[model samples]
Target: MLIDFRPSGRLRGKNPVDFDSAVGPVLNALAAGRRDVSRMRVACDWVQYRENFRDIVDVRPVLPRPDSAESQAGQAAGAPGYDVELAVDVRRSGTVALGDLTAARLAGDDLDGRVYLEDWGLAGQSCIWDFNALYWSALELWEKASGRGYEQALPGGESDARNRGAARELISGLFTVWDRLAAAGALPEELYVAELGVGNGSQAKIFLDEFRDLDQTGERGYYRRLHYLMCDYSQYVLDLARETVVAHAGHVSSVALDATRPSHSLGFLRGKTFLLYISNVYDNLPTDEVAQLGGRPYSVQTRAYFPPGAATELAASVSAEPEELPGLVRRLLRLGPALLADSAPEHIGDTDTAVRFWQEAWSALRLEERYVPLAGLDLYSLAPGVSGEELRPLLESGADVRMHVSSGAVASFVDSLPLLHPFGRLVCHDLFVTKVQDYRVGFRGPGKYDGSVVNWVNGPLLAHAGRRRGFDVRFEPFRHRSGGNIMTMTTQPGD
Candidate 1:
């Protein structure tokens, strides 16, 4: 007789990570959740593991398939989009108030610094498991509050009141969208979930929590059973992820690797199939670069929105506009009549500022008209050291960068100087990002109404990066989705 532990997957029959037959006792001990290392031990009943990649010796989790999903269409696409659509058409695109537009932009920066990035950095550290003996014990408190299945946060109204509210709001928004996306085929799998620009592994924690199915005995592949992997360029951040993972089971950290070329540096990626994600990291990586997928199931999530000012403020230490944030938000709400030439018909007389604004604003508006595109277009661009901040400024200043609004035509192939290197397969999702120069995106005045500028940074990246293969992708019109782009397959890679 055998008592089974571990959760089921989208597929049936074989358990994705069950070591029941191989390490029966080990499974029992781990499920018991001992506090000390010596207290935990697994005893497999006469079953010996033959595989090298998975074994009871390690006492870790090894997931076979992707994470599970919950199917739900975006609840707001219909109503929110409809309201914004009418506002864009009748409100006089360039004549709106500019009072709060500046403030809104600055808030994006603040959000990045004080909120999103900072909290995430903290969550990545080893202290995560400190909440309770079981890593999930401490985390589950927050997960229940947010509606997204994340177990690593302190819930709202906890002793740490401020931390609790922040965790609740942020995780709730992120996971609700994420779970719905995975259910919709946007996220590949919960087990192999990867966040390309995982700021703090908050999203990764949700992915793993889902894989756990709220039970330790619920998933297969112990000793190799980790379900989510996070990567970040900053050691300061990745160190946190290492601590969190190692404390619960076992993990490696302090590895240096390039995002675009993760193949050479990413070790776990060696033999397993995985779901990949990239968020808020595009500006740091060159536009032409992409992670090489060797026939593995993966998705890239990116956030185009300038998260609320508090979120962007985490990087305030490195940003130039840290102090100007409050004042900028003040300008965003008003949108017009002052600061923008379009507010006054007579002011449209082509002064450099006004001319630049009109030109960029109109280009974006034209793309907005193409919101309901006639057909998919392949787009590509090649430039060096051009960051997101740089592009936004140029477009606002009237630079003539052409938005590459077509499908990329290059043969899909990974290049290398070392004679011949091989991989299982190659898959590509080439997203056509908006040429920041094309749109005079504004919260107000003659430009397109920015329900929010950072929407592109958040929504598109998270949405599409979570998009699975063979699934049709579309976004709400004028929702500032997709980075105003499209993702296309370029080739069938050869092994």
Candidate 2:
């Protein structure tokens, strides 16, 4: 895979290992601190390689703390995206190949303390063996006369390369963005999240499991408390999501909701405040010109499959100026949590990607005269909360991003569910905002990283505002995606 040097200065890579390879310091930390470190794991969904981490098979490296400030700071500080610190605190002083892994803050004499992370690098390529393992395993199977007969269909084989590429693209590109926000999602106390277009709940499962094991210490439910609500237009999908969460065991509550007209009860909506949300609905939304892309007729009909057909359909799930969004978000904040939503740019390939698609798509929508508050609204496009620094990469890379200022009603409808925020938001104690991301410049989308947008959304622009201020907000973007998103602690916004 090729590494794209981002205009933002963050080095872009093909996979996690490329990132780990660049940060050799983390690898060094592990080798050096062999004694004190209790255990460690790759933390992210993919497994990481340190020249020798595999040697210690019996030792299960605990999943790196998902929420932490030190980890989120580097990108906020404009460090290159491909390389970030794989931070961990140890009981004794030691080091790993990735970097100088060390002991955490003492916070007095308490043995139990939190570790602080900093930037580092490793020498090897890190990867997730699970995908291929599953794919290969399935291939071994063949249908039998009594039951069923068929060759095991491996998902990551040469035959499934396209799917694997799609999977990798989906994960490395889109998921990384979510990973950045997850840290904030971890910050909240009680959180409710929603999955907009949850396809068979794959991403939904990933996040639900994440929440099930949220960061917590010392007995008493060792993880933050979470109440999850899932919604999908597909009843079958909703059923799958419900089953997925329930089967996961002891940590999440799931429910179904509709994007067009949310069927969730006000009691549930009013009852629980939302924290973090990870949306991939845009993956299903249509990409067309709202009017024109940067004053141009931004229209492209790709042979590619487009997910969202129009904002109108998506708007169906929301109220234009939902009065409820703010209250729910505020409540979640008051309760303590954040949100993260995932969206792919309308046009996913080549230059002029989906810019014209969204621009034209919006204009084409025959919005109902009833006036949806945030739904069918795109004020965030004209006025976004992301910031000039933030928008810069998307603009430089010509990444198509359509900003929206969804009204309260629509925003509220979506806000009512429990969502997933990536690791970045959850790990940090405080948020650091910036317009530019070093790695973000690669798959760079168009637009200036607008702090105003980030600021605005972090404040008044969003519907989920607890009675107090907006939130302990922070913004860190990665292989950036479509639609604007926010990452908070346990509870942030949306439902």
Candidate 3:
């Protein structure tokens, strides 16, 4: 029998999965049930983080098709038995839970049909994003109820974009580029720079403030001709950002637009923008995870669910039935907190109560994941113009692996690329997994950041997509901060 165990480093000093205690009993049960136990393979994936799913021991029967690599290998070795995939979360399951899961599996309780709610499609299309959108849409209420701003939840309680030194360096680089253009008499009358996901506007304030000061000192006059557009999906964030950059009102404009489809709202600026800046945005965008296992590709499907106990508690909090929770959640996602309050006043008395419900629901929510085979890469769409073929090289780069597609990021990148001037560039700083090996080392998120979802943007995949579009894409460690996961990605016209 083949036993594959993937252990997490987080549980150092502590046994993440004890072979004797956890695997021995399961193997014994399997042997007792089946005569051909020697032909079976058991693969275990253990994670230390709490995912959106609540399953302690998720066991799925892996039946490789006749055409699959696994089956072919088994046929060659004269081993025809099937495989079993076991996924465990140490954060939620203990030794007793593992034993119970083993007994349950022996009793033919695969736990595949058991779910708290309906499947939400692929991970990217999950209703979690709807909750994310509602979070941004009702920022004020969330912040008031949480007693802290979203920015406060970041690693350093702020973004590195606000670093004055980084802003100064970027301003210097822009001035040098603009000076050369000015000398050639190629500079446009109105210089343009846009910042996407302008969180709280502090980054814009730093950039604009530095640009104005440097331009005046250098006598470049670029500041006066500059047009700074602050674009974000949330009007609430835009409003807050507008207030933060009020000093540069003459040169700054707030645009309430979706970051994933910037071209839809800023199409007029195509090929006119000198610089497009993004920070901590791509990671927050929706993404789908794909896994290459047994030489076959599979899409990760997810379903948002509330644990039975939590669901019961949540229902009681809102004075409703557990069956009604899904409808309420759907309603909350469809309508923002304030609207939900007005729409379901009988359940949620006011906006404050609605916000409380949102928080409680968010806390209780979990995602159940399963792997579904893909027909072909061409049939998959990463974004509108981007294809799943872009993920081919990365997925097949090494042994079996799983990585995010960053569908939303790719869409935003593709849409924003056309906005750049011939001599312009796009720069983004966020949590980027630059190497495919990195995904194997640790969890790359789908983790929560305050009220939003975050997954590490697949930097190599983005680079691949950029190169295909006649652009040079590169990533460097964020120069502003010494210790952090943030990486700087710059894209410009390729030679």
What's the lDDT for all of these models? 0.27, 0.28, 0.81
Cα deviation of 459, candidate 2, in Å: 14
Report how far residue 82 has shifted in candidate 2, in Å. 43
User: Over the full model, what C-alpha lDDT does candidate 1 score relative to the true structure?
Assistant: 0.27
In terms of TM-score, the best-performing candidate is: 3
Q: After superposition, how far is residue 8 of candidate 2 from its true place, in Å?
A: 16
lDDT (10s digit) by residue, model 2, range 1-495? 012222223233542134444333444545555533222222111211121111111111112123446435744774322211122222111233323222111111212221111111110000111111211122122112113211121111111111222234333432344344455663345444434445445555665444333332222232344445555544545665566666554555555553424434334445343322434222111111111112111111111111123332322233212223233222222221112011222212321322222222222221100011111122223211221222222333432222222222223323333222322121111111123232222221111110000111211122222212233433443222323232222223322
Ranking by TM-score: 3, 2, 1
Q: What global local distance difference test value does model 2 have? A: 0.28
Cα error of candidate 2 at position 277, Å: 1.7
For model 1, how does the per-residue alpha-carbon lDDT over 340-385 read when each residue is reduced to its tens digit? Answer: 3444333233234332332222122111110111111112121211
Give candidate 1's TM-score: 0.28
TM-scores of all models? 0.28, 0.29, 0.89
Report each candidate's C-alpha RMSD, comma-separated, in the order given: 27.4, 24.7, 3.5
lDDT, model 3, position 20: 64
